[model samples]
Target: MWNGDGTVEIDGFRVYYSEVECVRRIFERHPETAVNVRPKNQLVKNAYMNNLLDLIDIACLAPQELTEEELRDAENTLLDLVGVDFELDWLKKKLDELCVKKTKMETRGDCMRELDRMIVEQRQVLLALEVELKNEENEAVSDSARLGFEDVV
Candidate 1:
């Protein structure tokens, strides 16, 4: 089933079956995966994570169905996924918490100074990303202008 917001609400087992069937169909019809358009990395990552979670569920509920090797592989893959970097919002939230902690410290020791240095460095990185995004937008606008109205349409 699909929600109004364009998100699916399917069981993990159903997801695994559906994805397997889809892959089967694709392999049967078009083995070569050459295409002009490709899914975004984020979307691919979400699907991979979903499949991994489904595997974990199966391992929990029906351990004998999967081989020990498969279980070990899945566990290692999950750990690798878990080690991915935190999202921007989460990083910002943790940074704010660190700032509060540093402020609450009574003395300006090496720990407090290191926290301050890290906070400043992270702020600089954020600012640089913002500047890069603005630069990209400006470049797009200039590219469109150079292409002329007819080409844009």
Candidate 2:
């Protein structure tokens, strides 16, 4: 329940405002598990387990709602999980939405500005990934050439 201010008292324990907000998000995402509440200790354990499971899901299973920065940071791991072709396909799909769809749809003022910013960021990330791939390809070629000369000598 609610106890004045922004705090919530669940099972005789007072949780802070920020913690309640995080729990609210979790509950919103998992409404079925949110409904059944037993004791305080069990609720806490369940919440912890749910949070851990969510993290594992984000890292390994489904990567929904991942930001550009996160994808860039974990590019190798993601590529390993889903393959480079799949990653590129997904990125192209998102770029198409951000580039073509948004321009076609009419957005105004602040929303338009935010959308524009997002498009620019995504474009930059795509460019960087391309450059990185090219660099790696060049390095591999050079390394193979060096090994060939070593075998000759």
User: What TM-score would each prediction reach against the true structure?
Assistant: 0.27, 0.26
lDDT of 2 by residue, 47-113 (tens): 4334433433444423335555554544434333233112133433444454333344434456888
lDDT of 2 at 49: 39
Q: How many clashing pairs does model 1 include? A: 0
Q: How far does residue 21 in candidate 1 sit from its true spot (Å)?
A: 22
* Best prediction by TM-score: 1
Question: In order, what lDDT does every prediction score?
Answer: 0.49, 0.51
Model 1, range 1-153, lDDT digits (tens) per residue? 544544443321123444555434433544332122233464654565464445435444443345546545655554454444211232233334443444444345667888999999999999999999999999998877766689769
Candidate 2 lDDT trough over 10 residues, lowest sum: 79-88
Error in Å for residue 116 of model 1:
69
Clashing pairs counted in every model: 0, 0
